[model samples]
Target: MDDINAWVWWLVGAAGLGIPLVVTAMPEFGMLSVGAVAAAVAAGLGGGVVLQVLVFVIVSVALIAVVRPVAARHRTQLPELATGIEALKGKQAIVLERVDGSGAGRVKLGGEIWSARSLDGTQAYEVGQEVDVVDIDGATAIVM
Candidate 1:
C-alpha cells in the first residue's frame, strides 16, 4: 500500500465510475467521475484523506442535486413544433379534382397531391376550389 500513491487510488476510482458511465449511459456517473478527478488532484497535492474525500463528496452531491434537475428540465422540454401530418391539418389546399365526401377526390396540398374528402359527408368541392384541411385519415385529408 505504501508503494502506491493515494492519488493513484483516486484516479482508479474515477476510472471505475467512468466504466458505469459508458456502460449504463447515465450522466450521474460522469458527474461522479469528475468529482473523483478533483479528488485525485487534491491527493496529488498532498491533501489529507479527509480533505480529498470532502472535495469528492461535495462536488459529486452538488452536481447530482443542482445540475441534474436543470439538465432533466431541459431534456424533457420540447420546442413548439407541429410535425408530420399534423402540420398539414388546418392548411389550405387547392382541389385538383371534384371532392365528394363519398367519392375519391384529389387535392394539391403543400405542393403535392393528396387524397381529400369533405368534412360534411353531403358537402362537395369543385375543381380548382381552395378549401381548409380539417383532419387526416391515414393518407386521406378531410377538407371543409
Candidate 2:
C-alpha cells in the first residue's frame, strides 16, 4: 500500500465499481465509478487522502441527487405518441350515414370509413354531421 500510488488505488476502485454497474444495470454505481475517477484525478493532483475522499463523496452524492429525479421523471412519463386505437379516441369524424345508439352506422375517420355509433343511447347523428369520437370498442368508434 505504501509503495503503490494513491491514484492507482483510485483507478482500481473505479474499475471495481464499474463491474457492479455493468452487472446490476444500476446507474448509481456508474455515478460512484465516476466519483472514483474524480478522486483519482485529485490524487494525481497531490490531494491528501481526506481531500480525495471528499471529492469522491461530493461527486457521487451530487450525481445521485440530481440525476436520479430526472431519470425517475422520464421513466414515469407517458409517451408522447398515441398509436393504434388510442390515436382514434378524441378525434373528429364526419358521419357518412345516420348514427344512433341503437344501431350501427358509418363515419369517415382518419381518412378511413369506420363503423360508428352514438355515445349516448338515445341520441342520434345525421349524415354529414361532425361528431367527436369518445372511444373505440373493437372495430367500432363510439362518437358524440
Please list the residue runs of candidate 1 whose C-alpha ends up more than 4 Å from where it truly belongs after superposition.
81-86, 99-104, 116-125, 134-144
Error at 137, model 1, angstroms = 6.2
Each model's C-alpha lDDT?
Answer: 0.94, 0.95
Among the numbered candidates, top lDDT falls to 2
Model 1 Cα lDDT, one tens digit per residue, 13-128: 99999999999999999999999999999999999999999999999999999989998999999857889998898999999999989749999999999998998999999999
lDDT of 2 at 13: 98
Q: What is the Cα-based lDDT of residue 15 in candidate 1?
A: 99
- Model 1 scores worst on lDDT over the 10 consecutive residues at 78-87
What is the Cα-based TM-score of model 1?
0.73
RMSD values, in order shown: 3.0, 3.8
What tens-digit string does per-residue lDDT give for candidate 2 at 62-113?
9999998999999999989999999999999999999999657999999999
Write down the TM-score for model 2: 0.64
